[model samples]
Target: MAEAEFARPIVTVDIVLLTLHEGRLCVALLERSAQPFLGVPALIGGYLHTDEDADAEAAVRRILKAKAGLEGIFFEQLGTFASARRDPRDWSVSIAYFALVPQGALKGAANPLELRPVEAAGELPFDHQEIVTAALARLRGKGAYSTIPARLLPEVFTMSELQAIYETVMGERLDQSAFRRKVNDLDLLEVVEGEKRQTERARRPTTLYRLKTPVAVFDRRI
Candidate 1:
């Protein structure tokens, strides 16, 4: 193997932070503060600090906090993107990750973070649109038959709210009765005592529940 072939590539961590906003699936984007694409909307990302970051996840966490003012959100490694022409600055590779959080959690800092509908976020820099598409596919695929959709809800929520989050991510409507039955069978949630809330459309207060555990598992029925 040639030494040149083994040369280290410029590595960066890019995050696709997703949330439910105004009844739509939204992705968080940060306007680039420096060049290659100055002032252009891009995924929250930065060069991985070799000495400072212990791993790619650590680098992602630091970048999210620094760029998006986000922390403690549900995130997972989506994939890796590498193309010689991906970055105009150099030959670069990016470790891509996706996170899900409730819109309420992002309230104060969303000013700097542009929350665009996933379908409408066009032409992001450095293969980012491709990255976002991958993340969306992962979310929708896992959402069916997994507890992944719970990450987009508040700690306490009614079954209707849960269904709404699922539908929003899946980009389709689910039969309410069937959805409730499936959720009950999964046993992923536990009812919260003395916690109930009613939406404007509800005739009565609905029972609230929270996840029994954070880890999501697949269910064959879904």
Candidate 2:
């Protein structure tokens, strides 16, 4: 095989940081600081440090903290995007990841990243729109049968608030009675004793609960 046929691959990591803003699902996009697409909004990404990053996950953590000023958020590898034309420089491979954070988490973010609705984060650079689409599919697909959607909620919340995040991810209204029953059946929450919030029904205060685990998978869809 010709040596030129196997060009050195330009490796990088890109993250899709998601959160709920204004009751809508949104993603964080950083304005590129360098020339490939200077000043353009794109996914949070950077070159993989061969000497520094212990692994791709390590690279993701480093990039998220360095580029987006984010850390300790729940993240998972989505997949890899590699193509000769994906980058103008050379053959490349992007180790893509996605993360979920609560809406209030970014209130103090000092980075240049801005939230854009998943439906309207248009024309991102370097096949990023495709990466976003795949990440969204994974989120909504896993969300229907797991507690993944709860990651978008604050540390403490009412059942209504939790259900609202689920509805936002699923893009449909769920039956309140059935949804609560499923939540109970899954044993996903533990009551925040002595904490309650006033709801539409002023006579009775709604109870608040916190997730019992990071993610709980149920057999049936929500």
lDDT of model number 1: 0.86
Candidate 1: which stretches are off by over 4 Å? Answer: 1-7, 108-111
- How do the residues 93-116 of candidate 1 rate in per-residue lDDT, one tens digit apiece? 999999998876776464478889
Q: Residues 9-110, candidate 2, lDDT per residue (tens digit)? A: 999999999998887999999888887888999998899998999999999888877776778889999999999998877888999999999997875455
lDDT, residue 127, candidate 1: 96
Which ranges in model 2 have alpha carbons more than 4 Å from their true place? 1-6, 108-110, 199-202
Q: Could you give the C-alpha RMSD of every candidate to the true structure, in order shown?
A: 1.9, 1.9
Worst 10 residues of 1 by lDDT: 103-112
By summed lDDT, which 10 consecutive residues of candidate 2 come out lowest? 104-113
Report model 1's TM-score to 2 decimal places.
Answer: 0.93
The global C-alpha lDDT for each of the candidates, from Candidate 1 onward, is: 0.86, 0.89
